[model samples]
Target: MSEQLITPWAESRPLPPYKGVLAVDAKDFTGLPAVLHAPVSQMIPELVDQAMARAGLTSVLQDKRFPANTGDGIVFGFDPAHLPFVIWPFLKELDEVLAQYNLSVGPRIRLRASVHVGPLPDEGRPDDGNGTPRNDTHRLLDSRPVKAVLASSSEQTTHLAAILSDRVYEDVVLGGYAGLHPDRCIEVPATVEGKPFAQRAWLFIPSPSGNLFRAGVLAAEAPGGPAEPADAPAQRSGRSYRGNTQNVREGTAVMGDVSGNVSHTSGDTRYTATNQHWGSGDNVSGTKNTAAPGEQR
Candidate 1:
């Protein structure tokens, strides 16, 4: 017999309209050293699916595609009400999943989530055949608290740190274009077992080929000290990319894409030093030429 499809309680049953949007970004996936890239990419969607299931929320993985340089990735929508109970715990699951692949979550692979609450249009495309909302409408499925959780960008900050770490290899990179917001990075402090840990951030790399890849923490500072002028690909970095956003400032490392779109921004910086250490050709440990299952290389 075929397995029964599980529907979210919110979908199957009548529910009040929710009031927030939760945007999630996988942590340091792009900067993962080859050893960790495949596994993290594979697990991210699964963990997200599991969180949605546990939250009794309905969601659909959208059709948006990342740029060519990025690795296998997934982006789905979820209800905001499930933030604390479902989303956050689901992110924590990364620790165990990474271990199975001989990887650790580290301060790097943590995720970043942004939540926004406002008037959302009711009419939009359907995300699933089940008659669920699509596009930005799905964002309304979350609650205020859930929205707050997402806006906190906690997990995103952690992921950003790992992205900034040169030791980590990324399967995807985003935002490094000439006319976009370069500060696509988010910064946040993290703790483990009651101990203070590292801060995290992210970077958006916009390839000239029109593909967008996101690097976590390691992305901000290139592996070597400030890139040499001759070696510098004509990429732009700084707050000016953000346009008129007053929140951004100089020395912000915030940059823009070729078309001048705003990326993301935050204030974490631990991955800079750590990644430089690992990616500096000193620790070339791990299986080489081993691509993750279902990946091209």
Candidate 2:
């Protein structure tokens, strides 16, 4: 047999802090025996590359750390701005790939993904590095909210659950352009080994209706806490974090004689139906007539 040689990274520059760190682990992969590891290890990189390319982010997977044959997952440190279009869409495609694999085989190769933004410390290995942010991202995969969402999705058509750190939510998803609704995300505390890791990470699942997963409304506590109260008000409109709402149907006021009115607000102003009359006490401004009765405005 010939002697083997190992190559190093062409650019061994010091690893810098990344604005967003993505960590993903195959759920229940450890329970498999050694023989099964090789297939998963070999397939993951290809799957990741394909998914990233599909999302038009082919470069994001280039320098990232992928799991070895015995390892359990992959880690990526990238620009925070990519979270909305690049990373989020990549995850959606990734889920499709994994779900297809499950359909091809008998068992599902579900993935639990977590995203966080922070400084990353160099581990001296360009290929694989670990730091506080990466660890927190991994620990977030073990969070109760993530696990619960994953379990809930098992019976559904999709088998992926993504958890976003508070910073990612506030800065990216909440900032806009993610194509995801804030109401679809629920704040959940991320805990690992019975200790709190992230105080208010957001959890989301692609909806089974061929849309993003539904996280439903969540309570204000860590995993295994009390359920949402019965009196919690339901969201009547499909309003994203900072997006505009277009009312298509007439809204009925319970106690007032305002009749039925449809209203929508985009920025700094509110527009209502012309048929409806609003009093000064209603505090509504900029009423414009864009639609007739029973027509979307």
Candidate 3:
């Protein structure tokens, strides 16, 4: 080798192998008393084992599984082949496992999870599953959409909310390998805090819990929030939000805390109309709204 060309590929750098990345985070984990941290953290593996068994993928984490602890959660990598199973029975089973566990625990554990599939580098450390996919997994877990789903739901019923990368949604759910119904997934954006990462992702809730309302999945959700899917109404039966019972168009009564404005009227009303008599006890006025005689008009 008297002379050698300094070409880019001359020094072969092998590509990292593709892996299925999963991140599960416990909501308000730090809010729990310090004495419970170790016990709660120890239960994670048990929860995953139960979930894996229920999904019939007992070997999903058998070997080379790198689990990184984030104090309140874990980020792990496994064979991509098991991803479909993870999405299917695994997620639902995890929800059930948490629910069953919650029945006995004083401070229940609720989770936000994300799933992604891509090339992942061998970790520098045992728990450090390195690569962009790992980063993506955690970002999706921290995304606003997924957080909103959990925030909007009653803490008692909804045990988990998850975000799936578009790749996983297309490859596993859409490809029908996982038996997971595509309709159960909601489209949302994944954005990382103070980072330039943003992408389309799919959201899944094992149980909608008490998050449902007339026209929104989250309370005070912006107009740009997720569009209500066509079949959503049928799923709202027997669900309650906050302390209020949802009765659809029949009527709804909310007695819990409201962070936003609530308005209603019995007569034909225009939010921007002036000098119009609209029947209402509590209503929002965007413009000039006439009131009862002797009252502020």
On lDDT, the candidate that comes out on top is 3
Candidate 2 has which clashing residue pairs, if any?
A: 205-213, 206-212, 206-213, 207-212, 207-213
Writing each residue's lDDT as its tens digit, candidate 2 over 111-179 gives 778888776654546544456677787788887667755664544475778888888888778988687
What C-alpha root-mean-square deviation, in Å, does candidate 2 show against the real structure?
Answer: 15.9
Evaluated at residue 207, the lDDT of candidate 2 is 38
- Write one digit per residue (lDDT tens) for candidate 3, span 1-297: 555644776688777788898889899888899999988887876787788888888687576368767878777788899988899889999999999989983679898989999987765655356667888888889876688668767878889998999999999999999878776776654555466676778888888764454324433223665353343334443322332233322112232222233333435431221121111111122332233344321
Q: TM-score: which is higher, 1 or 2?
A: 2
Residue 83 in model 1: lDDT? 33
- Evaluate all candidate structures by whole-model CA lDDT and list the values in order: 0.30, 0.58, 0.69
Highest TM-score scorer? 3
Q: What is the lDDT of residue 231 in candidate 1?
A: 34
Order the candidate numbers by lDDT, best to worst. 3, 2, 1
Error of 2 at 39 (Å): 1.1
In candidate 2, residue 211 scores what lDDT?
22
